[model samples]
Target: MVAMVASSLFASLDKDGDGKVSASELRGCMAAALGEDMSEEEAAAILAAADADGDGLLDRDEFLSLAREAECAADEGGRYECLREAFGMYANAADGEEQCITPASLKEMLSRLLGTSQHLGMEECRAMICRFDLNGDGVLSFDEFRVMMHDGLM
Candidate 1:
């Protein structure tokens, strides 16, 4: 099922009729359907993680690799795992650390996940942190992230 969905998704993402998916193509597709405006940095990071041949593009296998990780979103326990992966992807990209996600990092993640043309502002990101930051440290710890996901705050 994931295979078929990933294939179909890949086709939609490959708007240029090319066999592989480029960062721009991926962003354009996300921006269109999900209405999210993925920044070049975010798109590049995704492609970087998925691109197998280091060609800066996503082939079938590459896209499937990402799809498999995301497939976890379907299950309750795995949903947290999926969100953890997303958090790691953006958090690690920002500072090469996994401690916590700052407002800037959250902004980057929201830009890709929201599927909205109007990307979230820093104030919004800060507010999100404020809403979820249990320790009141102005950043989202993994524990806080779990709470946000559990609350379906996305």
Candidate 2:
């Protein structure tokens, strides 16, 4: 059952029905499927997450590769649940009724969750923030942070 759901989800994510997902297509599909409003920065962060080959696009294989990685990290059910819980936590920590989690907040959350320091001078974190900060705001909302973390873990 989980596999079936996962397969369906992957197919839906493969927008354009071309068996491959371009960056724009993936972003649109994710936004639509997740029922989340995303900023340009958020979309870019998602793209970077799924584009494992650094080709700026995601083919079916790449998508599957990400799924496999996630599956390995946690079974499908566990991963899905973790994501749901994380989303809830983020929503609760949002700045206002808008329920938006900023990039700075995301960093803090990740650092805490990962047992890192408040001041992360790691190159990985720097690169992640740079790659996902679409508006040059130097901050990523919950939506953006989720996408970035999804990609990184995968």
Candidate 3:
């Protein structure tokens, strides 16, 4: 069951049906799977996180590693719970704007989404900010946020 689930997850991430996952492909997969838009920078960060070998791409093995982590975390309760938490954080950050997620807001949002008070220290958030801050203004516009989140899916 685990292998099947892992395989499915990997296959999904391997967009374009290619045997290998390039940096761009992985970014697309993350956005699709996470249901968020992604900016070019955000796409890069997601790719970097999944590309364990640092080969600028994600292989099946690397994807499985990430899937396993997500699976384990989800098993604690449910994947939807985690996703819901993330959505709530993002929604709050939106603050009535069409595009609510900014780099600073994403930091706070991810911290809550990942359920970490401080130990993890918002590594994911920082990574996202680093990747998506297009104007070098240290923030992401709604469109940028959407792109980063929804790269491959849409």
The predicted structure with the larger TM-score, 1 or 3, is 1
| Backbone collisions counted per model | 5, 3, 16
lDDT of 2 by residue, 1-154 (tens): 3354456556666645777666666556545434465676766676679887787666766666776767688976886688766655544343445454455544554554333223454565556667866666555555665675576444
Query: Any runs in candidate 2 off by more than 4 Å, and if so which?
Result: 1-5, 75-80, 83-154
lDDT (10s digit) by residue, model 1, range 1-154: 6677678667667766678988888778677545569999899999998787999999988888888876654787667677787567556334565578888977876566444554889998888789888999888878888877666442
Candidates in order have lDDT scores of 0.75, 0.59, 0.58
lDDT of 3 by residue, 102-150 (tens): 5456665444333333323455656666686566655565555555544
| Higher-ranked by TM-score: 1 or 2 | 1
Q: Global CA lDDT of candidate 2, please? A: 0.59
Ranked by lDDT from best down, the candidates are 1, 2, 3
Worst 10 residues of 1 by lDDT: 89-98
Top candidate, metric TM-score: 1
Q: TM-score per candidate, in order?
A: 0.48, 0.42, 0.43
Candidate 1 residue pairs in backbone clash: 34-115, 35-115, 35-116, 36-115, 36-116
Off by over 4 Å in 1: 72-154
